[model samples]
Target chain A: EPEVTQTPSHQVTQMGQEVILRCVPISNHLYFYWYRQILGQKVEFLVSFYNNEISEKSEIFDDQFSVERPDGSNFTLKIRSTKLEDSAMYFCASRLQGSEGYTFGSGTRLTVV
Target chain B: QQPVQSPQAVILREGEDAVINCSSSKALYSVHWYRQKHGEAPVFLMILLKGGEQKGHDKISASFNEKKQQSSLYLTASQLSYSGTYFCGTGPSGGSYIPTFGRGTSLIVHP
Candidate 1:
């Protein structure tokens, strides 16, 4: 079975530095999404992308956050300036349709110090 | 809004049954079920759309009640492998593309 894969399984960055988390969603999936989970917290939706554009985003996805599907298979999330709170397990997910359940990547653990 | 999951944690013995509930404050278009083992990605189990649909996988089953904005996952005759954190992701009505997941219910099944 094809699965969503993410690069840099774990990352450590300085508090004010920029960070990019990369993901390659399921080959045939269309809708792509980014979610984050703070240690011991529920997974929170960050943004949803379709047609190479952002469909929806949460409050947490503020000015610092951006997503790009630079290529056919690569989906990337960029944080312009990281904050301590940005440290979390960032997950990339994709689904064929709204009715289908999403397949999530193993996740990229971002650590800011 | 985030869905509320009941019974933060549960412990069950092999061959036992368990039910986890998820309730949302807003109207929902669909509810998705997923299971995540420690340190691993979440695996999709099933999705229940509006109009009161029920979907199941093997011995795991789930039901979505749009009228009440709630969903429930049923694990019957559970095995030790069923131990994990189960999440209910809710897609609100009005074409909201992002699904908000509940806090998750942690289940520990023992042999």
Candidate 2:
């Protein structure tokens, strides 16, 4: 089955540095989302993107976070400045329609030091 | 808001049954179920929409009660392979596309 794919399975970055997590959603999927899970914590929603715009975002998705669908297949999340608290497993997911369950990528583990 | 999952963890023997509950304070449009094995991505199990519907996959089934804003997952005749962390993602009323997932219920089934 077709699945969501993310690049850089793991990343280590210095605090205050910018990081970009990339995802290639299923070719026919229309809605894309980003979620994060701190170690030993529940997965938290960050943002949802549709039609090249943000549909909704959580408080965790503050000024430092932005998402872009720079191309037909690529959905990218950019963090302007990384913090220790930002270190977590960032997951990218996509759904073809409002009715289907989402397909999530393996996830990119972001480590900030 | 995130749903509250009951019984943080449970252990069952093969051929036993298990029930995991998820409750939300706000009205929900839908509830999604996913299972994650250690160090692996969560795999979607099923989705239950409003109006108290139920969906199932093989021996795994789930129920969503819109009136009570609650959902439950039922694992019947469980096997060792069923061991994993199960999460319920809830989408609140008013078209919230982003579903908030609960902390998860860790279940272990031994042979």
Candidate 3:
């Protein structure tokens, strides 16, 4: 089965530094999303992208965060100045139009010191 | 808003049956079920839409009740592979379709 792919399975960065996580969503998927799971917590939705623009975003997705579909296949999330609270496993997901399920990538574990 | 899931955790043996329930305070447009092993991404199980629809995938099935704003996931004849945390994500009608998930129901199936 085709799957969403994410790079930098694990990343450690200093607080106040910049980090960019890359993802390649499944081809032909119209909806792409980014979610994060804090240690021992429920998964939280960060943002959703469609048609090259942000469809919706949660409060957690603030000015510090941004997402881009730099290409037809590559989607990226950039955090401009990370904080300790930003440490978590970030997942990238994609869904076909009218599909019930969203295929998720393994995840990118971001750890800010 | 996030849904609430009942039975924080359950222990079962092979072939046993189990039911996990998820409820929301707000009306929902769709309910999605997923299973996640430790330190891994959640795997999609099934989705139940509004209008009181029920969907089944193999021995795992789920039912959604829009009136009650609740959904139930049923596992029949559970297998060892079923040992994981189950999450129910609920999306509100007329929203951006960004579904929020419950804490999760942990299932530990032993031999």
Candidate 4:
């Protein structure tokens, strides 16, 4: 089975610093998404990307958060200024259609201190 | 709005069966199911679209009731490997919509 690859499986950064989480979705998948799971919490949607632009985003994806498909293959989530509350496991997912199930990446465990 | 999952957690022995239910206040076009092991990302289990469809695979199955805005996941003859947190995600329409998930139902199977 094809896997969504995520880099820096675990990342530790100082509070107030910047962080970028990277992901490479399935080659043919058309829709990509970013989600976060706080420790012992429900998974929360961050943003969805399609057709090279953002299709939808949640309130959690505020002014400090931005997503981009820098190239044709790489999808990235950038946090302008990290906060202690920003620590969580960030997962990148992709699917062939809007109504289909998602293939989630292994996730990047972000830790801010 | 976020969906609701019943039996926040369940404990079962191998060969036993279990059921987890998810309900939403708003009508839904599709329902998605996922399972997440501790410290791992959520893995896709299955999806049930409108028309009150039901699907199953490998002793695991799910049902979607679009009119009632509810979905259920059933695990039959469970195995230890079936232990995980199950989540149900719902989409408002068939279009490109962001799916939201419930808090999740934790299942622990023992031998």
Candidate 5:
């Protein structure tokens, strides 16, 4: 089975620093999404991307956050001036055109000190 | 908007059965079920697109209401491996594929 891959399984950064989380979605999947889980809390939607542009975004995705498919295979989320509250497990997910089911990456645990 | 999941947590013994319910205030286009183990990504279980549809995988099954506003997941003859958090994601009828997930239902099955 094909899998979505996320890099830097765990990252710890200074509160005010900028960090980027990377992901490689399924090869044939067209819709990409970013979500976050705060510890044992609910999974929160961040943004959705398609056709090299953002299709939808939640209030959680503010000006300090951005997502990009820098290359055909790489999807990245960049957060600037990170705050302590930014610490969470960030997940990347993708699905094919028909939207049968979503495949999620293992997730990157981001911690701001 | 987010869906509401019932019985935030459950404890079951091997060979027992359990049902987790998810409800939404808005009409739904599809319902997706996923299971997540500790410190791991959520694993997709099933997706129900049509209203009044029911599907199962192994001993696990799920059903979507005719109104498309609610869904229920059933676990039969549970095993130890069935222990994890179950999430129900809902997508209101539209062109977008983004799904809003419910909080989650924690299941602990012991042998």
Candidate 6:
């Protein structure tokens, strides 16, 4: 089965530093998404991307955060200023056209010190 | 709003049957089921759209009750592989594609 690949399985950064997380979604998927799971909390949606632009974003996706489909297959999430609370597992997911199911990447564990 | 799931956790022996439930306060356009092992990505199992439909995969199946805004996932003849956390993601009946996930139901299947 094809899989969505996320780089940097684990990353630790200073609280005020900027960080960029990368992902390669499934080749045929049309929709891409970024979600986060804080320790001991439910997974929360951050943003959804389609047609090379953002389709929808939650309140958690603020000015400090941005997403880009920099290349045909690569999707990225950049956090301008990481906070202590930003330490969490960030996941990348993709959906094929006309499909309700989403395939998620293994996730990158972001830890801000 | 996020959905609520019943039975925070469950432990069963092989071949036992178990059911996990999810309910939402808002009307649903679809309900999705996924299972995740510890420290791993969630694996999509099935999706139940509106119209109170039921979907199945292997011995695992789920039913949606559109009127009640609830869904149930049933697992039969459970195997060791079934030991994981199950989550129900609810999508509101609108253009919102982001589905809110429940807290999750943990299942432990013992020998």
**TM-score per candidate:** 0.96, 0.96, 0.97, 0.97, 0.96, 0.97
TM-score for model 4? Answer: 0.97
- Model 1 ranges with Cα > 4 A deviation: B93-95
Candidate with the larger DockQ of 1 and 5: 1
Taking the candidates in order, what DockQ does each have?
A: 0.88, 0.87, 0.85, 0.82, 0.82, 0.85
Model 5 agreement with the true structure over A1-113: per-residue lDDT tens digits: 89999999999999999999999999989999999999999888899899999989988999999999988999999998899999999999998864577899999999999
DockQ pick, better of 3 and 5: 3
**Residue A86 in candidate 5, Cα distance off native in Å:** 0.6
Each candidate's lDDT (Cα)? 0.91, 0.91, 0.92, 0.93, 0.92, 0.93
Per-residue alpha-carbon lDDT of model 3 for A1-113, expressed as tens digits?
89999998999999999999999999989999999999889999999899999989999999999999986999999999999999999999999864477788999999999
lDDT of 4 by residue, B1-111 (tens): 889999999999999999999998888888999999999989999988775899999999999887788999999999999999999998773343677899999999999
TM-score of 1: 0.96
Q: Best lDDT goes to which candidate?
A: 4
Which residue pairs of candidate 4 clash?
Answer: none
lDDT of 1 by residue, A1-113 (tens): 89999989999999999999999998889999999999878888899998889999988999999999998999999999999999999999999986788999999999999
Point out where model 2 deviates above 4 Å.
Answer: B93-95
Compute the lDDT of residue B23 as modeled in candidate 3. Answer: 95
Kindly give the stretch of ten consecutive residues in candidate 5 chain B with the minimal lDDT sum: B91-100
Judge candidate 5 at residue B50 and give its lDDT.
84
Q: Which has the better lDDT: candidate 1, or candidate 4? A: 4
Candidates 3 and 5 compared: the better one by TM-score is: 3
Q: Write the per-residue lDDT of candidate 6 for residues A12-53, one digit (tens) a residue.
A: 999999999999999999999999999767888899999999
State the lDDT of candidate 6 residue by residue for B19-80, as single tens digits.
Answer: 99999998888898999899999999988877579989799999999899999999999999
